[model samples]
Target: MFFFKKFFKKKKQPVDSQQTTDRQSVQSVSKIDKIGKGKSQTSRGLIKSNKLFMAWNKNAEEKKQRQKSGLVADSYLKQISPKKGFTFHSDYFEVGDGVAQILTIVPTKNADRQLPPFWVTRMLPRGLGQNVTARLIQPISTKTEKWTKDNEVKADAAVRQAYGERKVNDPSNQDIAFQVQDMHQINEDLRGGQYHGSEYKILLKAPDVETLDSAREQYKLRLKNNFRGLTVEVFEGQQKDDFENLLKSADAQIGHEKKMYTSQELAGGYYLMSKGIDDITGKYVGVSEGDFNNPAMLMDVDDWSRNIVVASKFGPRTGSYSTEVFGDHLRSISLWGVKIAEDAMIQNHRVVHFILNNTDIEDIGKRKIGADLSKHTSNINMGKGAINPFEAFGREEDKLNVYPTLTEKLRLMFKEMSPSLNDVDLNKYFTQLLKEFMEDKGLWKPNAKENIDTISLVGLPHNEYPLLSDFSLYLSTIFTIYQKQGNQQAIKSLEKIQGVVDRMKEENGDIFDKHTSSVVDNAQTIPQVIYDFASISERGRGIAMAQFINTLGYATQNLHRGDVVIIHGVDQLAPEVKEFVKDNLQKLTRRDVRIAYLYDNVMSAINDKDFNDLTSADYTLFSAMSSDELEAYKETMKATIPSALENSLISKDDLLYYLSRDREKVLFKLDLIL
Candidate 1:
C-alpha cells in the first residue's frame, strides 16, 4: 500500500480535454526558449539555470587562446629586456699603461669634523709610488627655499598642536609657555640662510689591479686616520652616467648627481688658471723658474707692483726690493743672509704651499738657531793651546753666552793702559770694548745712531729690538753711576756703548731695507753673491726672513690692481712677526694687491687667537690634519655648534654635518672653501 501511494504521487494526473491541450503547448514553448537561451533542460520538462557556469567556460576558452599566442607567458620577460637608456660600465678605465678609477669624496652625515674635500685628496697618497688626481666640480649653491618651508610647516604644526584651542578667558597662557619659548629660539637659530653642495672627484691610477686595490685600501685607511668624518666612494656604474648628465646642466630637470657650491668656495684652492695657460690676458712675465721670488717677478709686470712705500708706523723707509729687479737680474740677486726653516714653496701663476709644524717647540727651536758657524770656527785656534776665549768668559756673566773672553781681556787691557783710572774710568774702558766687539760681530752698523733716533722718535716698543734694548740698558746703568763722578772720558766711553746698542737696533730695522732690495736687485746678475749666510745661526735666519716680509709689506703698499703677493711658511714666525705680516697684509690690500698666504697644519693654530686672525681669509684651502690636531679641534667644534637644532638636541657631530651640508650656517660663510 505504501509503494502504490508513492507511485501515484509521482505520476501526472489526467486533465480535461481543452486545458490539457493548452498545458502541453506551454511546455513545448518553454523548452524552445530554454534551447535558444543556452539553458539546460530537466527530464520533468522543468527549466534549469546555469548562466555562471557558461560564463566561466567562455573565460577559460579566451585564456587558452591568449596562451597559445605567447602574450601571457612572456609578459614579465619584456619588462627586463635592454632598454633605450640603460647601460653597464665599469668606473675604471685604462690610461696609457695603467688603470684609473674616479672616486667621489663627501662629508659624512653627522660627522664630528667636516673634513675639507682637499684633505681627502691629500690622504690618497703622494710621491712617485702613488698617482692620483683630484678634480673639484662645484655647482651653484643649494637652494634653501624647501628647507625653509619645511621648517615653517613643522613649526606651524607644532604651534597648532601646542595651542589646539586657547580661550581669551583662560586664567593664564602658562600651558603653552615652553612651546612659545621653543618657537622663538627656533626662529633665532634659523635666521640665516644655508648654502652647500660641492662635488669632489679623485682619479686613482695604478699599474695593475692588485696595486690599484692596495692603493684604494691605503687611501681609505689614511682617510680614516686623518679625517675620520670623511666618506669616500667609487664613482662607477650608473653613478658616472648621472654625473655626466649633471655636468651638462647642474640645474636640469632630469635626474643627476650634481651639487651646487658658491664661486668663492670653488675658487678657494682650485688652480682656476693654469699659469701660462690662463695668463693670456696679461703681459708676459716669463716662465716661472719656481724660485722664491717667482711671485715678485710675475707681479712686477703689472703697474701696481711699483712705487711702494713703507708703512708709516714702520718708519720713513722706501721699498728697495722691486719685482722688476728680481726679473731683470734673476741670476745676479744676492739672497743676503735670508734663510727659511719651515717647508715653503711658491710657484708662479700657481698657489703657495707651506708646511707648518703643529708643535710650538719646533717653532721656538727654529727661531733659536742662528747660523752654522762650526765650519768657519771649528778649525781655528788661538795660537797653540791659548785658553779659548769663549771658555774664559763666564757663561753665567754672559747671560746669552754671546761675548768671548777676548772681549773681557781687551777691556782689561784698556784699564791697564790707564793705571791711575778709577772705577768710573774702568767702566768707560769696558763699554768701549763692548762697542768694538759688537762692531766685529756685525751687530753694530755705521748708521746705528740715525736708526736709533728714528725708532725713538716713532715711539716704537723696546721689544722690537729686545737684545739691543738689553745692551742699551746695561750701558745706561753705567752712565747713571758715572753721572755724579764728572768723568768726561768715562762719559765719552759710555756714550760709545750707547752707540753700539743703537747700531745693533738699526741693523735689525734695516735688515730688510737694504738686504731685500740688494738681493732682489742683484739676484739675476750676481748669482754667486747669493750668500746663504750659512755662518749666521738659524735664529738669525728666522729674524732676517721676518724682516724681509716686514720690508716687503711696507715697501709695496701701492700694488697695482691685479698684483698678487704670495706669503708662505708664516706659521713658524714669531708672534711679533706674524702680527707684522698681518698688518702688512692690510697695507698690501689697501690698494689692489691680492695676497695669498699659505699655511699647513692650520688646525693646530685655529685655537690660538693670533693664528685665528691670521686664518681669516676670503678663500681658504685645507688638507688633512694630524690626529693630535683633530682631537684638539673637537673641543672647538663642540663650542661652535648650537645646543639645539630643529626641535631636537644637537651634538657636535650634528653641527658639523649641518655646517658642511648647509655651508651658509652662521658658523660658515656661504662662500666658504672646504
Candidate 2:
C-alpha cells in the first residue's frame, strides 16, 4: 500500500515553472515602477507601505509654508540675510515656556561716541516664529536753552507767590509800613546802594531773584497808583537749565527701579513677588524661580499657593542683582522660625532632592555637584535658625565656652563617630586631643620626651577604654593626676588595664629578641620601663610574697633543729614564703631546697647538689620508707658508708662519686629491696 501511494503521488513542479514564476514577479515590479513615475526606485518600499513617505511630504510642505510666511511657532528667529539690525522675537507662549532672541549691534566705527543698539524679539505660540523688531532709542540731548524758556513762566509765577506771601506775613513793622514804591526804592538801593555807615558797608552782597522780581511787581503797582519816576534796574540771572534739570530728574527716575516693598510694606503685603525687568525698557520680562520651595515662604505669606509662587519667583535672585534676566529657578525659601523648625527635617530632604534634580546646579563651575548638594543639605539641616538635634548644644554660652567653633566640633564628631564599633572610637578622640594640646594649648613641644610621655599616657588608656576618651571630665581627671605627679605613675597603672587593642611590643629582651620586631624599634623605651614597673607591681608581687612565706617556713625549721618541717614541692610554695623566712631567720643554711617522696612518688625532683645541700640542719628532704625497711632500720642501728654519707652533709662531687662508685652493687641492693 505504501509503494502504491508513492507511485500515485504527483511529481514535484519543474525548474522552468519556477523560473516563469520569477519572471512574472519581475514584470510586476517593473509595472509598479512605471506607474509611479519611476519614483519607486528612490522611495523606500517599507516606508511607503507604512505611509511614512506621505507624512514626511505633508510635514515638508507645511514647514515650507511656515518658513515663507515667517510664522514658525515658538522658535527664535533672526533675519540673517538682512543683517542691518537685530529683529528681536520671543517664543514664550505657555506658562513655563519662552525663548527671547537678543541681537547686539556693536558700532565698529566709533565705539565711544556711538552707543550700540540692542534689539530684542519674542515668540509667543509653540509654532509661531514671527520676528518682532525692537530698537534701543537714544536719550534726548541736554541743552540749557530748552530748559530756560520751558520754566520761565513757572519761575515768574513762583517769584510772585513768594513776594505775596512775604508781604502778607511780614514779621517786621518796617516791611509792612514801607509803601510799594518805597520797597522798590529800597530794592534798587540795595543792588547798587552807596554805603551809609562805613563799618557796616556791604558785609554780604548778592541779588535775591525773588526779592528783585517782587520789587519790580510792587514798583509796577505803585506806578498804577500814579507814583512815577521809580526806575529800577533788576539784574536777572539767565534762566537755569530747568528743562535739562527736568530731563535729568526724569532720567534718574527712569534709570532706577523703585523699591516695591519697604520693611513695613513687606510686612503688610502678605505676599511678595519679584520679577526681573528688561534694562532697556523697564518692563517685567523674567521671573526668578527656585528649584526648591523655600521654607520661609510659609511664614511670609498666609496663602500657601501665593506664597509658594512668590518664593519661587524671588528666591532665585536672593543673592543676585544682575541685568541678565536668566537666574536660578529655585533659590531659597525662608519660613518663620516656628514653621521652619517644625518642618526642618522634611525641608532638608526636599532641598536635597531639588539639588539632586537640578541640572543647572549640577553644571555650576566652582564646586562639584555632589559637594554643592552636600553643602545645601548641611545648610538646610544645621544652618542658623535650623532646629537640628546634632547642633542642639549651640547655645550662646556653649558657643563661647566651646574652644573650637561649630565646624571644628562637627568635624571632630564625624571623625570620632564609628558606626562599625557601634560607638565612637576614642583613639581618634585622644589623637585629636593630643593634636589640640600641642597646637591650640601649646602644651607639648614637637618630639619632646614630655610630649611622647603625654601621648603614651593618653593614647594607651584611650586605646584600652575608647568610651572614656571623649569624656572631658575623664580627661580632666587624668590630666590633673598627670600634672601633679607626671605621666610615669599613670602610665604604670594603666598597664594592668585590659581591653581590645592592637598588638603591643614586647618589652623584655628575652622573647622578642628572636624575631625582627617592630616593637623594639617603634615602641618607646620609657613606656617599656613604666610597663616593667607595672608588671612587677602586679605579677612580681605574687611571686615575691610566696618566696617570703617559704623563707619563713625554713627559718622556723632552723630554730627547731631536731624537728623536721617538710615542704613537699618547690612549686607548692606560697607567695609570702621568702619574705616570711627573711624576716625571722638569723641565717638560712641553703638558698634553695627541694622536698621528695610524697604520695608514693617524688614530690620534687632534686639534683645531687640540691639533695646534698638539704642534709644541713636548716633544710630537710622528706621521703616515704617501705614498711619492711622501716622495721629493719628500727631493729638495727647500723650505718653503712653509703647510708652514713647520704645522711651526712657532704660535697656535691663527693656525694656523686659515692653514688656512682658501685653502680652494680647499688643495683643488687635496689633489686633485693624491690
Candidate 3:
C-alpha cells in the first residue's frame, strides 16, 4: 500500500506568484492568521478524505492481487481478472501471482506493410529463447475511413516532430522536405489500398522477474543482431497496461499509440488449427480445445460407422517447420513464404524460398521496387560485426586511439556472423564498404555520378554486391554514432580505404577491370533496383546475366553456410538480380544454402534454361495453376513425370497440389495451407 502511494504520488506544483512572501506582506496580520486557520481546517478534512480513499484503493488492490494469484476466482463468473491482475513496474508488468511478469515489445521505428522474410525469421521462438511465448495480436479488419483518419493524424504528428527535431540542427529545408515527401507517400499508400492498419505487440511472459530480465536483455541483443532498422525495447509503466488491453481486444484502437502497421505485414503469421474438409458432409470445421478432446465433436455420416470417437493428447508435430503447417487462412503466400521459410529444413538441407514474378518496368517496377528495397535495407542484418574496418591502420594496444575502437568493433560485427568473406578479396570489398560507410556517415558527399562512373568501370552488372551493401550499412551506422560524438575517425577510415583502393587500382592497371565494357554507357536506361540491387541497363540482359553470375561468385559471402534463402518475386527483380539467381542456382546449393524459387508464371520457369536443373529438386509442387500453365508444365516434364498424373485432374477442393520431382516422378496429391 505504501509502495503504491509512492508510485502514484503527484509532483509538487510551482507556488503561485500571488502566494509569494513579497505579495503576502501586503495582507493584514489578522487576515493572514484567519487564512492560516482556514487552511489548517481544510487540510485536516482533506487528509481524512485522502486516508479513506487510500484505504479503499488498498483493499481493492488486495482483492485484485488475490484473484490474479488464483487464490480466488470469481464465485459467480468463474473468470480470471483480466483487467485487474497486473501492476505496471518501471519497465515491465508484475502479475499479482508474483511468479510471472509481462513485457511488451516497443519497436525502434515503424515497420513497412510488407515485412521481408529475414525480418520475420528473426522472430521465431529460437530467437526469442525459452520460456517466452510471443503473442502477436493484429487486427483482421477495420473501417477504411477510420484507418485513413488515424493514419493522417499519425502522419501529421510525425511531420511536426521531424520538423521540430530538424529545425535545431539543420536550417536547410531539404531534410524536412524529404521527411514530408516520405510522410506523403506513406499517407497515399495507406489511403489507396485495401490495407487495414495493425498494432504489433509481442507479449513475453516469464516465470520470474530475474528470468524475465535476462530474457529481455538477450532478446534485445538478438534483435539488434538480426534486424537493422527495428529492434525492440521493453514497454515501461503504463505502456504495459496498454499492451495488455491490446491483447484482450485484438482489434480495438488504443488512444495516442504512434506505431501502426498494414495487414500485409502482420497477416502473414495468421494461422488456425482446424480440421481438413469433411469427406462425406464436405464441410470445413474448427473445433474448440475442449470439443477436440470430446468424442462427440466428430460426426458419423457413412453406413456401418462407429458411434463413438476416441481422442487423446499428443505432442505437436516435429521435423516440420512452421511454413509447412501454416493453416489455410492466409492472404498472401509470398508474405507467408518470407514469414515461414527461414526456419525450414528439407532432408537436412537448409531451404531458401524465392517468389519470382516478371518485373513490369513501366508499372510496379518504377515506383514500388525502390521503396521496397529501401525498407529492406534496414530490415536486413546491417548491425554489429566482429571486425572494425574503421580502426586506424596500426595502433599499439596500449596507445590511446583517436576513435572509439571498441564501439567500431561492435558495430562492424556483421549481424550474428563471423567475418568470413568466403573467396572475396577482403581488401577490395572493404574498400567499397568504407566508401559507402563514409557516404552514410555524411563524411563524404554522396555522388551518384561517382557511383555510376565506378559501376561503369567495374561493369554495371557487377556494381551492387550484397556483402558490401550490408557491411556499408553497418559501418554507416557505426560511423554516424561516432560522428555525433564529435569523432573524425570516419573521415580517416574513409581516406584509408579509398587510398588502399586507389593504390590497388594503380597497381592492377587495366587488369583491375573485371569487365572492360561499360553497360551503363552502352545499355538502355535501367529503371528500378529492389533490395539495394544495382541499377543496370534493362537492354543489357546479357550483361545483367553476367553480373548475376558475378554476384553469385560472392554468394558464400552473403549467405550463411546453412542458410535457406527463400527469395520471393525473383521475376520482379532487375535482370542483374534475376540473372544472378538464375546463374547461381547450382552454385548456391553447393554453398549449402538451399534456395526455392516460387514463380507465379509457371511457363516462364519451365522455359528457363535451368528448368532441367530444377528437375533435380527432391520435390516440385504445383498449386493453383492456370490450365495452360499446368498443361505446359506437364508437357515439359512429361518424360520425367508419371503417366498417371497426365490424365488426373487436379482439384482445388482441398487446395491440393500435384507434387513431383522424385526420380520416379510419381504423382502425389498434397493439401497445403498456401
lDDT of 1 by residue, 1-674 (tens): 00000011112335657533436435545655566575555644332334434544566577678777787557766676433442334756554556656566555422322225443234434432545433344344354667545755676676677686766767545645545654554455445644334455555667766777776666666666776565567755634443444453234312324333332333333432212112232322123221111121121112222121100001111133332422321110011101111101111221111112111111122333323322221121111111111111112322232232234333333332233445554454664646544554444434554543221211122223224344456667767877889978877766654554454346543331121222222222211111122222233544433324323422232234544544333444555345445655565466545554434334434544344332233323222234454455445443343332321212221111111111322121011100
lDDT of 2 at 602: 20
lDDT for model 1 comes to 0.37
Give a tens-digit lDDT track for model 2, residues 543-592: 22321221232123212221111221233223223233222222322322
Error of 2 at 288 (Å): 18
TM-score of 2: 0.15
Q: Which stretches of candidate 1 lie over 4 Å from their true place?
A: 1-550, 553-558, 608-615, 631-674
lDDT of the candidates, in the order given:
0.37, 0.24, 0.38
Full candidate order by lDDT, most accurate first = 3, 1, 2
Ranking by TM-score: 3, 1, 2
